[model samples]
Target chain A: MKRRDLIKGAGAGLLAAGTGIAAPAIAKGVKQWRMQMTWRANSPLLATGPQLVADYINKASNGRLELKLYAAGDLVSPFQVLDAVADGTLHMGHGYPAYWAGKLAAVQFFAPIPFGFTSQEQNAWFHYGGGQELADEVYGELGVKFLPSGNTSVQAAGWYNKELNSIESFKGLKIRSGGLGAKVLTEIGGVPVQMPLGEVPQGLQSGAIDGADFVGPFNDMAFGLHKVAKHYYWPGWMEPSAVLDCFINKEAWDSLDKDLQEIVKGANAMANQMVLSEFVTKNAQAVKIMKEEHKVDFRLLDPATLGHLGRVSQSVIDDVGQTDDLTRKVYASYRKFIDTVQPYSELSEMAFMNARAQLKS
Target chain B: MKRRDLIKGAGAGLLAAGTGIAAPAIAKGVKQWRMQMTWRANSPLLATGPQLVADYINKASNGRLELKLYAAGDLVSPFQVLDAVADGTLHMGHGYPAYWAGKLAAVQFFAPIPFGFTSQEQNAWFHYGGGQELADEVYGELGVKFLPSGNTSVQAAGWYNKELNSIESFKGLKIRSGGLGAKVLTEIGGVPVQMPLGEVPQGLQSGAIDGADFVGPFNDMAFGLHKVAKHYYWPGWMEPSAVLDCFINKEAWDSLDKDLQEIVKGANAMANQMVLSEFVTKNAQAVKIMKEEHKVDFRLLDPATLGHLGRVSQSVIDDVGQTDDLTRKVYASYRKFIDTVQPYSELSEMAFMNARAQLKS
Candidate 1:
């Protein structure tokens, strides 16, 4: 039978089941699915993103596809979301590709890289440039289908207990960083340690780490990083923009009808837009609260320090690009796209922003 | 008797009409819609945006709702789209709020303002920070439902025949500009003239204007602006980001089922994301092609010139804010949001972009 016939058959079944019920009629036999998210409970934007996606899909589909979400460690450990989705234990998983960086180095490029594409540039590359195709090739091999579901705008460098006035400050500094940032930090003479999000504040308090790089001000403030670290730095060169992905079991995705597939794609796109906008607004407000209430010192990475870090980052990118064939391909495509877009962005977004800074308003 | 009963009644009618047909089944009596767009036939991203929205809705709704698009002048003049939709002559219209700036001064704020929010920040404010609510208040009064459908990332300052080295150069300079940017330009020493997009290149060529501010490289290249002017300036501060909107007849929109309404919203959201990404990629490619193939002279407004323009922009904003009560409310809210967001943006987007510029990569 054709796909439409199958959908009609499902609808007929649903109509029979829904008869005599007071609940609103759905499209067809309600497909109940569970999604596991990597974000911890109450993780601000990260946690909110998955719920938003589920809500959009459920409402837009008129409850035809109901998606129930489980926070990190609710159903399974955060790290196991991908595995569960791949094994058909869960229909979908929401997490960053960088979470699986250990399983595949190329996956890191799919999330974020040091001195990489900002949120806008990254989305441009993913959707219009060849980033999505590369991601499909990588994820397809792992028996999963991936879609970029959310983004946190450029993250802050980190919250620091002491002033970082010069390049010398990075030497031997134990910073809680992750993904490609960790790699770049190590190359720049910093001791980069990857710790759980919940452990970062405690680590800083106990002097286990000098500073911790999380997301931007919204998530940063939620973790109360400003209370522990008096100085908040600028220009998060590492993971400039973090992308969240929704992974589905390949079999489960292929089984859906075309309309259902489009619904899923449309829902995810809305979630991506909404989540980023939420971050921008929330981060802005968070910065204000931090400044007024906690007396946080906003610091920019010195030009000289940034220059040195940039050089080291380039070296790190080059080393990673040499890892394997897929990694090389992904890196080459990313580098070319970024290089092509940078000049325009520098002249446009960069220039306008700088000009606005000089304004009295 | 109830909403579901009404829909079921419509489905029964469709079933009677669709008897023995091999075509795929739609939701019910398929609702056909006509969308008139303000963009010209060959307009680049602007024209493509409406088509993308229509395609998404048609496919996602399984043709239950089919949107037919008519380009500018195809059905009515470009500026008449909003009026057409408002009067139910068309179900929907795609245009920018700024087009109706003459009719309602406050409408311009919903589009792009001089030295206003960037695309990301604009989206943030519109979706999360009361922009949409204000827009509803402004547009709903006209019997239209508005949604942001597309965005062109920061436009170029304009195409100039002579280098703008100082604020003095702007004296007596007649540039083809529009909206709030034109207001700001007039305040600062230049003569800002409003003209159709088609007239800009010729105006610059025939010395009718000294320079013209159109969109960024992609659309600007399409207009062959480079052939008339050699100096391509940085930062289209006039419209840091231009937002395109879709206006639906309020009565027609309210008539849609909850699922169909969600579908329309989802389609427009996708279009917004897609259009912005397309601009980023295409604009970057256009810049590369222009530099290698056209040798356009890229210039940045000198710091002194930028500073002087920034000061004048503030005054213009102040004057515009005092126009009327509604305009005052819109301007006040816009200023408050921008102020609250500026510091975070300065430390995040601005700092990262500047730092990336100094990078070896």
Candidate 2:
């Protein structure tokens, strides 16, 4: 048979097989999807990323696929997103993989690790360095298809009421942090507290927490952390480049035709690029406002402290990876890619920034 | 009249008028387009960027809008791409805006400037900092629609036969460079020569050029420059982040439906992100190969030399911007965005990299 005849035969065979699947829904004109995000309505990059994804997909598909977005608590709680999407409570979910670290240890690597890859490097690892396959292997078992939909560049280290003069400063300090960052902080003698971002401002104000590491300047400014914290820190070492994921019900994904699938992928890719760029611009503007207008003191962590933290971070990552065999496999792949990308980054980005500093001075 | 009746009336009036327009093309199922690229067939990021854009559009449109890509010299010629696309000789073209410096001096700022915005900063500026509006104003007059399709992250400075130990080394030295970089070289007393990338290896081998700056390690390795040049330099200060452009014929663009237009835009955005990520991976691997297998000597341009070059680069940019009103407008906007983004980068990306270095040691 010719190729066209073979496709026709296969199509007829599949249809005649009486698989009561997505065919009926697809034929009903516009397919509406409900997507739940693990972010507040006005969350900066997190909320905007999913919103852009929906806009892009809707515009590109010409109403063929209409996705309605729901902020956190609209349908289900934030932490319940994975289970909700997996069980088909929602067609999709927008969240960070690290949020599900309690259930799957390897998920943290897929989100962001302490002292992990930067935004550019992480995207590279995801698309080209076998990351997507490894991610599929992990998320596949959960019955959800994973797509990295956005990035919040390198986050700010945190907002601090007191200066971090040395590694000893971390001892007995209460820090509002989550995911692997919390683990690294705990290893370094700091008390790590998990609280919703909404509570961070009050937590710092009430002296419940000495510091907090949120998304970045843009989101931190939104939370009014700079108003309470006098000193803002540099380089969010815990979550270097935080990635936001779009988790689709595996059944929903499998049901889509090739064209709809491609549209969804393209939309997610656009969102991934757009959100990072938006963060770069908005974060810069927010920093200027915080520093010049709000008088927030920008401070860098001392070299010795950073060095100590880095060492502790590595140990934390190793421990987390050893929890299961799959985590170990994913962690090994992540490490190898990071090692491979480091030298080039040193020669190019690192060297350029150093040279730029000299020029500015 | 009712809304539906008004639309029906307008449709009837237009049909009665019988204007010879896009009706016939809409009746045709698939719209095939030809796109030309200003890169060799085997070029890494440059060629791949445009090819991916074509692939994305084809797949997303379900072959309704098929784009066929032509490499450099395959059609008219590399330099004639802009003109060809504008005159409708080709439906689309991929190139750098700096290539059109002779026609529009302001165009170089849109592409890459010596010591200008980095990859992340540039994308932010283009999307958020009034760059797209300014770009539209410039390109609209030329009857083409411009879209930023790809980026080559920070490039390696160059490969040299001898060491660049001080500022004096640039004086009277023959360097193969182009665009703003060549102008900066001229200001710093170097005799900048414009040569094709293919001829760089032979030029260096024959002692015709002392050093050459190419795209990063990946493309540089493909050109076999490491075989002839022993010393590899860090931080391509000249073209910090070179962006690739996709130029579509205005007439061709206007003929498409809104959905198709969005698909094109999303495809270009996807290409932009994917290409940069691809470069990060490939360049890292290439650096490793050059260092281990080829034994290329890695060197940093001394602080004093870099500082002096930075000064001259500023002067070149300032002079270039003063050429016309549009150039000045773009230059002002570019400068403002750069200033806004620099502080955040210093606190985030720069600080993280520096802290990372301390830890590795």
Candidate 3:
């Protein structure tokens, strides 16, 4: 019954002209609502996961709630999704919390910060470690309901052109990165360019940027970054595990009946699982193909190199985390969670991984 | 909208007498179907996750379908769940695939094997990597529909009484374990004792077993293993990530309308995510408690000993995998998936973990 059909993007998702607003209307006997996502057309992990959420909600509601999806720039730009959803311009919008950092500093803490929580840790924090309560307090101020919808499990460090033997190798290099990772690069005297993922391949080939860390192998390979940059790197210290969130206007969310609300919540959780699985499965396949068929040279940043970056990352995070009162509270939670979970994760999953890796040829 | 409520196991889940048959009866204009689980009443990660699945299905269906849940031995024994579901004695059941290894050796591959796929990788394999198709072929023979419902993310190496410095330390010692882990223990001249997880604490206290590999810190701590054994070890090489599945009778599954079927599938996926997140969070909290409050001595098994265990494990798997044609096919798929996923996982998440661990105080 489960099929991996490519989600139709652009106009195909809606049978009727969408108002692109939060006010739901009763069409015949069904309730109609519009949803938008911060993803371009045919984007694999980003768009597909949200599309599944919309699909699940539409189907599981059994003609009660009909949710139509739109891609990034289909209704508005990716960065404006939060404001659009909050102001009732869109019923619901799916995007990364990091995209709203410029508007609210506290939101950045919810995104994947450098050397921060992994996907598993992030999920645990959101559900168990008082994260949802914190989210309610922070995002609730903007009249938006926040839900962790999807995650990009541990992205690749990125694609590179020149080999890195030292921290000095990063100086003056223009790299397309985002958030705390970008700040760390800036601290190291590298130019951090903020550009969309789709433009990265051309940027690297035409010398617009020396390097880029858009996403993991699956997404990076889709952009044809491997052809432009032979030295592909791993352990994306930039965004270890990015959590994608689904934002809904508080009024629109409150307007839904109890059963419809439950359907929406269940759809978000299902999409979270589906998104990570897709990333893990596709990244594995992509890496094997890039390595064996495309002759991409996969490189690891040495421990010393990573250590220097990690130090810079901590300082950058400290500056951002201390910007305001809400940011401080969120950072405290993140700090305690990481302090509690990291040691245990290292002993259990990380130790198992080291042992398993050695067993392989 | 999402809340974590303790699942009412045993009698509380049903309002009326359950027929425990696949033939759904109409009750107050709602279709009623009964489901049983391998978990006992009030089990944390195990029963709670599956109960949430039932709750989601119930609420999302909006009274169209009412699914009742039961705990282990409430309707039938834990080991009988598969057979009960297959024969339509139970409309649906939830349990690990390894429980039915005696009935069909091929089903064992679907469970967590020694040093096999991690939770993320396992999720990937089940969804992608042609695993579900293989499941349809393998489990379709048993008149049951299989869906991956939950997972225990990478368990601990388990608890031990004696310090493990060498392979000989395990010789002639009784350890409560099961599946391929038990087989590996037997290969190493250790007396493998099979018992329920709830019994591990009493067995260790009574000197019936010297050590036990019941589960990770969360469940094992719940069994009061920390009170029995001081030396808690790292990297459970036995069952890296065990996947718990929801099994539906072919007849019952086919009887559902398309919308109801989607609800069922969506609930399973949500449970899968919740289960792993609970494991990750609880294990982290439990380990911290065991160390600080209980003063449990956390230990690491040296790589040389793990290497030896891995070697025996492969041989044991080879013997079991070669037992029949279907098993061989399943084993081939497992091998291909691990070989493809492991290298990339090692370089990405594992590498980032090591780097992050080094950064912490």
Model 1: lDDT of residue A176: 93
Candidate 3 runs further than 4 Å off: A1-29, B1-29
lDDT of 1 by residue, A1-361 (tens): 4844654454355335543112232555777776879987567888777988787788777777788777776655789888877776678889988888788878878867888899999999988998888988888877788888888888988988878988788889999988878888888789998798889999999999998888889878888888788789888888688889988888878887677788888888888899999999999999999889878888899999998888888888889887999889898999899989998899899999999888764
Expressed as tens digits, the lDDT of each residue in B252-323 for candidate 2 is 899888889989998898888888888999999998988889888899898888998888888889998899
Model 3: number of backbone collisions: 0
DockQ of each: 0.68, 0.62, 0.68
User: Each candidate: RMSD to true structure?
Assistant: 8.1, 9.6, 4.7
Worst 10 residues of 1 chain B by lDDT: B18-27
Error of 3 at B28 (Å): 6.0
Native-referenced DockQ of model 2: 0.62
How good is chain A of candidate 3, measured by TM-score? 0.92
lDDT tens digits, residue span A1-361, model 2: 4844654454355336544223334546778776889997767678888898888888999889988777786666788888878876667889888888777877878877878899888999987899988988899878889888888999988988888999888889999988888888887799999888889999999999999988888888888888888888888888778888998889999988788888888888888888888889999999899878988888889888898999999888888888899999999999999999988888888888788877777
Predicted complex 3: CAPRI docking category: medium
- Highest DockQ model number: 1
Instruction: Spell out the clash pairs found in candidate 3.
Output: none
Interface RMSD of each: 0.8, 0.9, 1.1
lDDT of 3 by residue, A1-361 (tens): 1211233333333323444453445675577776889887568888877898888888888777888787876766778878878876678889888888788889889878899988888888988788888987788887799888888899878778998767899999999988878889999999999997778899999989999888888888887888898698778898888989898889888888877888888889888877888888888889899888998898889888899999999999989989999999999999999888998889888998888877754
* Candidate 3: tens digits of C-alpha lDDT, residues B106-138: 898887799888888888888778787787677
